[model samples]
Target chain A: GAGVSQTPSNKVTEKGKYVELRCDPISGHTALYWYRQSLGQGPEFLIYFQGTGAADDSGLPNDRFFAVRPEGSVSTLKIQRTERGDSAVYLCASSRTSGIPDTQYFGPGTRLTVL
Target chain B: DQQVKQNSPSLSVQEGRISILNCDYTNSMFDYFLWYKKYPAEGPTFLISISSIKDKNEDGRFTVFLNKSAKHLSLHIVPSQPGDSAVYFCAASAQGSGTYKYIFGTGTRLKVLA
Candidate 1:
């Protein structure tokens, strides 16, 4: 893809439901990241992937919020037992280089609304 | 707590005038700062960035200035145009060598009125 692509631009689920959001990073990009943005706030760090392995998952709100990138090119962010508070825009970004100093390109994001 | 802060919630500028947006960060470890512009229903688009090492960077009509000692950064747009009206977000990252999980400031909404 020419840019980072995210699936299901919007999702509405009841509390306790499970949801999966997908991201297809740009070809050959070595780094991927996930972020959450609540109403009226900026994107908050959720997780980061250096390659096939997650380099940082500390930002995940809890164990219920998990993400994975089985192949270095694509990633999935899964949320289980979704709470109303979990409602927010889940954003995905990718960079050619894995790490901080690189410019990341972001996707349109999935606006998950937990009703 | 928000590590990155954009205290001004909104700014109104006249067309053909300059617009200045400011941001501040409490984390000294951030090695780089970036500004993104967003329109309604669209994802943010990268504008300009400045490294912690340099005080300023210029790109056409957009310029970014970083003050490491003050932990502050600012974006200047020359001859602000109505099309430039959008929400601007400032982001900072710590340990640029490892991850790009940046801390972003609450966006500042700028309206350039003609």
Candidate 2:
């Protein structure tokens, strides 16, 4: 089966611009998550969606970051007025359900560079 | 503050040798621990996991050991092969406490020489 997939593997934009990263989870996955990874650091949680609704958004660094999963399969991570600090590899993952011991399958990730 | 820490940035081992990676956490609330392997330009893939209730979990050549009292865990691979070389990340979640988001460590790069 196909694993998770992300589009626009690399994106470069100017500071204060807007960018959107897309994620396509495996078929039938009910839970999706977004994370950001900076250089020399591990991935930091961004947001999570259960079905079409976001179950958790506490990991969003600020109001500038937002994510949505309209139909429950594909998710988009949007960044408003991006800053140089926001440059990093954006990762997306999904699992059958947001239950304990559930394994998440990850996508190749989209690397965003805010110039 | 980093809730999960992988002190070693890199490790090297010969083929068929044992490779051990360690992780420590500052949060006592974390009950579910997981290990992930990542190749360059790719997102992390799940490798193994252990629950706080169990001291150890083994699968094939990979084993994960958890020490709740010490807030630590370790992943050991026997007969390491070149294919095993990659960055390994340890993640923790307080699933029992209702939080499903994971806190991941910086990651340790492993090089298996054949």
Candidate 3:
């Protein structure tokens, strides 16, 4: 498919364990973003990477949540010591650029369930 | 604090009727606003957007109106179709931010009943 793709459409893990979710953006996209959507809420920004560097990560709930886009094409979100609170739909988005009129294309989220 | 808010959790309208979804923001710096539609288990798709400089933008059957003075915006769909039923989200961004980081509203689920 030409749109963003995310691996492991769904994941189940026990609390305190670690998990990794991957995202593959559309070809040539330079900006990638990670967001979490809980029941009855909108997706909240977690981190954003411009190329291989994280341009902003102020939305990360805590230090345990980390993400990286080493090559700027594929990105991974790593969660350590997951809690039930971490259960939500993890969404990934990509855009051609991060400047004005920025429009993001999103991927079908990976539903993370931390029991 | 939630910079953007969608007070209505859900709305139901009959097909061929008009549907209106409203949004409000508390941030004064937001210069651009956008609307997104999401289906179950799928990612949100960009619907339309309007800049603060414009009071209204229209595309096909959809129209978005922005009231910068009131910090409010609305999405209107004429002759709503059942396929248009989904969750709608409102997002905003400031101008100077290089990444144009978006702050999103909780979302309002709209059901276009056939």
* Best by the TM-score measure: 3
Quote model 3's TM-score. 0.97
Q: How much is the lDDT of residue A7 in candidate 3?
A: 90
For every candidate structure, what is the RMSD over all alpha carbons to the true structure, in angstroms? Answer: 1.2, 1.0, 0.9
**lDDT (10s digit) by residue, model 1, range B7-110:** 99999999999999999999878998999998876677889888887999999999999989899999999989999999999999876565468889999999
Which residue pairs in model 2 clash with each other? Answer: none
- TM values, all candidates: 0.97, 0.97, 0.97
Q: What is candidate 2's DockQ?
A: 0.80
Q: Candidate 3 residues A1-21, lDDT tens each?
A: 899999999999999999999
Chain B TM-score in candidate 2, rounded to 2 decimals? Answer: 0.98
lDDT per residue as tens, model 2, B49-78: 898889999999999999888888999999
Candidate 1 regions with alpha-carbon error over 4 angstroms: B96-99
TM-score chain B for all models.
0.97, 0.98, 0.97
User: DockQ numbers for every candidate?
Assistant: 0.70, 0.80, 0.78
**How does residue B10 of candidate 1 score in lDDT?**
98
